[model samples]
Target: MTTLGNMKVHEITRDYGIDGLSITERNIPSLSARQVLVRLDAVSLNYRDLLIIKGIGRWRPPAGRVPLSDGVGTIVETGSEVQQLTLNDRVAGLFFPNWKEGAVTTEKTHDPLGGPTRDGVLQEYVMFEEDQVVKVPSYLTPAEAATLPCAALTAWNALIEKGKIHPGKTVLIQGTGGVALFAAQFSLISGAQVILLSSSDEKLERARELGISQLINYKKTVNWEKAVLDMTGGKGVDHIVEIVGGNNVDRSISALAPNGLISQIGVIDGLKGEIEISKLMPKEGMVQGVQVGSREMFLRMNQAITLTQLHPVVHKIYPLSAIKEALTELEQGNHYGKICISAERNQ
Candidate 1:
């Protein structure tokens, strides 16, 4: 919050990967009119963060870019022109700050937070317009709130906002990652039945504690679609959160009920794959691509979280100095929830 003092930020250098990361001190930037200074308290890692860190494909940021897409912070200093926000208000930045409402566009999707074009929250302080950030639920801690910007909102947009997932609907979620678990939780909240798929039995058991009764081990039962069809009495599922892309989508299509919706959220398997249109046509299956949501959607999600007292599942929290370890843990794909970075001076 003090422009007079030097602040430490983790930067991406030419080397790339964990070795490429360097922490250096620079002058804390001054805020302009309409921009409020935020002291970021926490950061959460996403699969996309791993891609950015590894310098994969289009995810490769320019040299000296700061990486991370999700964070929760407090307004340490408010600009003179800023309104509707007071000092000490806790908030999370929107992944797509320009996509404030309704319908997406090329312009709205540009300059995403913590992506190649913009600096992220790994630093001690962030600056944004009051409109670019939304107040988090009062009951949620910084780490829990940190997970909302990307993973939580993506799941919400996929299930609640677009799919209208509720009672009488059966949702099949793939994996035990942040978005998948959040989708399972939201599905349960809306009175929908969930069938979750994971390679690990341990993760499946953990999901059971979240009230998910139907679990499938994709590793053991390779043809899990048949299991889904059998469970639904040959009716298939009403929704599928397609986290595993490539050929796995075809399998999801095989397990869809008539008019079922599949929210395409990830590409862990492969980026490009062909879909068998004949299968989808018979079921009228809809595959909707989901992006992290807007400010309006984030606010609505915060309200629902407040009402339900829902907590984001955090697998682990590492000190800011231990970010490389956090990223490595996320890369290993062993964690069941969001991985976070503590921004405390001593952490």
Candidate 2:
């Protein structure tokens, strides 16, 4: 185990922007009676991080806030009252610390990590209440494990928890970003066929290498909904991981089979638009907005990942010092999977 010492942390010191993020040195935090200190190895980027950085959404952080939700680390110290966690245990922080299990509630959703509410894990070391962390899968690298708490968990909640994807079902995944790719991987693990849509043929080809043969170039096929219907023999898909918001919702509804599920995970397209209620009414389709997930769901997903040896697709890794560059890469939206930040010096 590495020796613990003073830590360096990135804080949003100025107005909302990548430039506002500044790294500062601070003393290692004191452990509370129920808190455990962890040495973060890697942290993964999410679209939500970008939104928080830009102050684009409701969850904007105050100045000097640490800014990332998902990270994997090793426990270096534990308080006297901490019984569930021990030194050297590998774990990741939960996105929602209070919501350990069960259905989502207003109170549980209020204090998510990495935003305006609570400080996130974008530091070399962090402290968490013993119940706020989960063990990482043994087979995963820190980078892979870091990707699980947000993007991967969101996909798991949307597909496995809500969509109930299974054999013979067709899942429509939009874009080749983190959540979409995770959804595709989880769907394949559940024996479902995946039809991945991307603007770039190059990106789609890369996805094909991951066993997704059914590809739709949305740029080539302007009416991609028609293409989806054609591919399903006009029956449409069983589930749509709807990342694009706005009028894309209408198209997603159009591309669903009878009683299909649409897991609305992102709002890249825009926030508000006319929903074609007349179109959505006949299919009896269901649309559910996905927040990341509960800690219980994260534990269940980790068990499956460990059992299947499912690896997260990390497109690129940047040093913690290059966080601005990493956020730029994420904003460009060209990556095929999760963009990660490694705090490991050797990496």
Candidate 3:
């Protein structure tokens, strides 16, 4: 392996049926044409990274590499033909390095930051293409900016791109994780009413303080879909950010108004379950799959964030050496925002 100065990485790796990744060292990756070497400032954890570490679903990367989907870093070196990035530029890599446009799909979304596809940024240094990096907002810290690529972009894509959630529209966000919180904020910023659902009443109370119009404690209100209907005067919400797939889809579909949209993003509870298509037929509603957004969509989302002065909620951060613990905390789902990792400390 070729060394580009000094480099070390703390990443999650899984082989075969084994789980719980470990850290390892390798020669620093060299930059290719139109690529840049990035010195990682911080890396945020997404549920996708957790899925990859657990070797679940379709997120598995290639064999023998660090695992992660998104990270923020400063450009240290650039390839000869790379005109888009420069040294010291504050930027975050995209969810799909090669995906530049259009709706994301299985073939296009095959390669992500961490997992088996490519090396993740949980390490001290990583290499990326010029286009794969999106500039961070001046107001946000690297840790905060790091959360944008996967979770925020997914929410943005779900609302702005697919659901077209607009002013006067009503949107329902499930849970308190990065995506749901962003959905709530985006809805508020777009002049729409937001209903946040959570198992924890305490977190729901905090969301209320943030101006969330309504909070549904799903644990207390198991049939929360009916509550949504009541809140909307029996019209149902215009859009629902569906994080819990499987059995929950039926409820989400039931909560949609006429021509309503359901941005299907996750399956935290479990993916294997049935949905009643007839529930959607009468309303003529739509259930769209939301992968993270494109680079162009990311730029648009950045502009929206800037215009609204929106900030990503960061619950806690850990040093790079404590990646495992950070991941454990994320899996426990107690945080109201994102879990981050500081890369430089692992050296």
Candidate 4:
């Protein structure tokens, strides 16, 4: 067991570029009555984290905040009032601590970790209420487990929870990022056909190794929606995991079958766009924006992951000190899957 003491953390010391982040020291936080102290082993980067770090989004945190929402750690100490978890239990912090189950509401969605609200898990040690963390899948390393809290859960919610994807249903996944790949994986797990679109042919080929036969290179075919229509025999896909938020939504609408669902999860291609209402209206399709997911959904997803023995695609790993380089890599958008930060190196 590692000795617990003061911890080193990277904080957004200013609202600027990656250079705004500073590594500093802080005393390990004391646990409250229902809280537990955890030693973070790994943290994963998300597009949202990049937006938050750059102060580019609506949910920008104040300066001096620790920024990141996905991480896994082992409990080193538990408060007397905590009963659900024990020392040495491995768990990942929830993005939205208040969202335990059922439908999301304003109150439940208010406190997102490592953002405009709460502190994230980029530090070596963190204090969270026992309920704010979920057990990591036993088969996964802490780095792999760190990818689940955000990317994996968002894909699961979009495809299984709201999209109601099933066998024979066709799911269209945009890009080959963390969520997109997980969407493909989970869709395949449900016996659904996955048609993944990426600008890079190499990424498309990588998706093929994961059992995705239908791949589309958007760079090669600009009107990829037509390709989708042609591939589905002019019917279009049942679900489209829409990651590109610009005018691409209009294209997604064009590629949807009747009563199909478009799980709008990202805006990587530019935030503002004009939706073709005329095209969307005729299909009677639904476009639902998905937040990561609730704790209940995370638990359910973990159960499925354990049963399937699914492994997340880890594109790269970096030490905590290489946060700027990691963020730069994410900004370039060249990686095929999740990028992780290992706190063990810092320790």
TM-score of each: 0.98, 0.97, 0.94, 0.97
Q: Write candidate 4's Cα lDDT for 1-347 as tens digits.
A: 22466889888876566778888899898777899998899999999998888888785788888999999999999888999999999999999999999999989989899987788998989899889999989889888999999999999999989988899899999999999999999999999999999999999999999999999999999999999999999999999999988888989999999989999888887888898787777888988989999999999999999999999999999987788999999999999999998885524
**What is the TM-score (0 to 1) of candidate 4?**
0.97
Model 1 per-residue lDDT tens digits across residues 1-347: 34557788888888889778899877778888788888899999999987887799989999889889899998988888898899999988889979899887889989999899998888988889879999999888899999999999999999999999889999999999989989988898999999999999999999999999999999999999999999999999999999999889999999999999999999998898788889999888899999888888989998888999999899999988889999999989999989999896653
Best of the two (2, 3) by TM-score: 2
3 or 4, greater by lDDT: 4
| Stretch of 10 with least lDDT, candidate 3 | 11-20
What is candidate 3's CA lDDT for residue 19? 43
Query: TM-score of model 1 relative to the true fold?
Result: 0.98
List clashing residue pairs in candidate 4: none
Number of the top-ranking candidate, with TM-score as the measure: 1
Q: Arrange candidates, best TM-score first.
A: 1, 4, 2, 3
TM-score of structure candidate 2: 0.97
RMSD after CA superposition, every candidate:
1.3, 1.9, 2.2, 1.8
The deviation in Å at residue 324 for candidate 3 is: 1.2
lDDT of 2 by residue, 125-244 (tens): 899999999999988988999999999999999999988899999999999999999999999999999999999999999899889999999999999999999999999999999999
> What lDDT score is found at residue 89 in candidate 3?
93
